[model samples]
Target: MPTQIVNIKDQLFENIFDHAPNGVAIVGLDFRWVKVNQSLMDLLGYSEEEFYAMTFPDITHKDDVAADMELLGQLLNGAINRYQIEKRYFHKTGKVIWGLLSVSFERSPIDGAPLYFISQIVDITRQKEMIGQMNAITNIANIQNEKLKNFAHIATHDIRTHLGNLGVISGFMEEELEVLKNNENFLMLKEALSQLESTIDNLNEVRKSDFSTEERMTSLNLKDFVDSAIYNINAIARHEQCKLINEVDGTFNVMAVAVYLDSVILNLLTNAIKYSSKERQSYVHLRSLESEDYIILEVHDNGMGIDMEVHQAELFQFKKTFHNRADARGIGLFLTKNHVESMGGKITVESRVDVGTTFRVFLRKA
Candidate 1:
């Protein structure tokens, strides 16, 4: 009895196992559970009796059992002093749990025989989940950054090109003004200057657009915005002799920024007019449909449709246009796509050469 008391004292002092908050366990050299603490039972939702009745292999996750057994063999064979690793375990209720496990060998005083193994298991599920979420967010931010970089390059190049065009025309006007002062042809030169000014204004507006602002959202009536767009572009539509057809439901609403939505709709409407087939009567269809997830708008025109093979990839790129229409500056579709995506929406096109084109806009329902 005295010897047994000394043994218990030595085990308690040398083990230093009981005070740890993580589960502490002891397994015999034969890989069976010899002792387990209160923390271990609590972690696995098992009684002490239930834990003792099973071997370590039975509780370990099946995928981890073989690897853990190999680590145990290294401990038993005196190849390692301690082993630390992350592994999964099967709880009493059959849930898989992640744990950080550290194990060391134990030796008996009698003849220095290998007695058992001591293991400490720290639960790390919450920390692991947090790491996964952080990685996902980081990936999304990287993709957004790449897209923003592309947008900056496009805006710079396009604005610079328009500025260059204005400079060339301004130079011509300077020479013409000196040669033919107040001549009737000067009115044509003045008109060109006015158009250049309009182009510069459009460029500045696009540059100043801040699509990232969360405060820009409000519930907007689709028909009202479309009407506003139509009125804004009345001159251009009238010139093209385009008939505007509206099939939108009166009460359709969407969560969007008012100015950006107005710009998007106006651009689409004008594009439908601009690309209308010269041989046929120009007609544009502004249609809307809705479902639980999205509000769908289609801008359809009987026009000289796009060639998908060569132009599909560049369709939404700045300064890219398949048609050589006189008014095409190539920024409208690019800006439209960005505006749609900025507000948690998407835009796509369906077209074939000479088969007409459909621009589909999908906005989230408010």
Candidate 2:
């Protein structure tokens, strides 16, 4: 070749090797590293001398070497002139790096032999990381979706049962009130009517326990909250021959929505009183404990407890009543659990038949 032609060819070769954005490696036909540029050194974390001493096979991950060697055989057999694949390269630090590798053959200008195997490696580590994160998030979402579906089914059943009971009770009250309209005990009848109205209002509030409007949350005093809720349910407690024991002392604050917290406490307390053993009087204890990041408010009752082995799975379900009684509507614990978790809290139950039940409500520390 002429001297000027040789000089232009050398300049073109230098430009391609030095300025390529992707990692470029020139290997001998024997699969030994012949040259490496700055990009290749950066991608593989190898120095120029270190890379030159290693063959292409030496830097490939052990798991990928077999498949890569098979591809190489195919390439050498003239099955393909160029091929692209995602492969892993072992860095000098022994870390695996994902890369989109494109390999092509080049014939020598002097000998017309297969003197060069030119490979370009495009790094794709960040893409792989993002894919992994997306998959993890998808799995978590799937789990939550199943949980929510089960919750909805239970809530619907319990609410329907409660509404049915309320309908029957209201109908009875109407008939009795009509009979007592002209009786000598009119004042007592009127008082009973007022109490029924109040009870109905409270039930309405419980039914509307969708606290989705609250955008903010804060630590609330458990003692005060329960006391206020008990005051509201005092009439029902008295009529049911129930006693509420307040063991919660001081302010045990937890991050929660005010309405939701009130509804949760009220429902659990009423549930205890409602399910009290018919032969014995009902009593409830509202207690609290402070932990590092949560406040646990336990509502314990000496009422009819649960059979955990048979009912644990369905305990938080809507409208699933364990006892086949006219008053067992089953929405109390369902609503309580929903209200608790909606504000980033949790509720769990421990119980034994006839012994009693304890509901542990865990809320974020104030």
Q: What does candidate 2's lDDT look like per residue over 230-345, in tens digits?
A: 77677778888889888886767777776678778888888888888777877988888877778899999988888999999998899999886897788877888888888887
What range of 10 consecutive residues in model 2 has the weakest lDDT sum?
184-193
Please provide, for model 1 over 1-366, each residue's C-alpha lDDT reduced to its tens digit, 9 standing for 90 to 100. 599998999898656665667899988877788888778888888898888888888888788888888888887787888899888888889987789999997798877778889888999978988998999999999999879767866876787687678767767777866865556455455554554455446545555665554556778898887765665566677778888888887788988876578779988887788788888888888889997788988889888899988898999999997877676889999999998988789998998777688998998787
Candidate 2 local lDDT, residue 226: 82
TM-score versus the correct structure, for each prediction: 0.45, 0.46
- Candidate 1 lDDT for residue 239: 77
Reference-based lDDT, residue 97, model 2: 88
**What is residue 240's positional error in candidate 2, in angstroms?**
30
Alpha-carbon runs more than 4 Å astray in model 2: 1-3, 108-113, 174-366
* Model 1, C-alpha of 273: deviation from truth (Å): 1.2
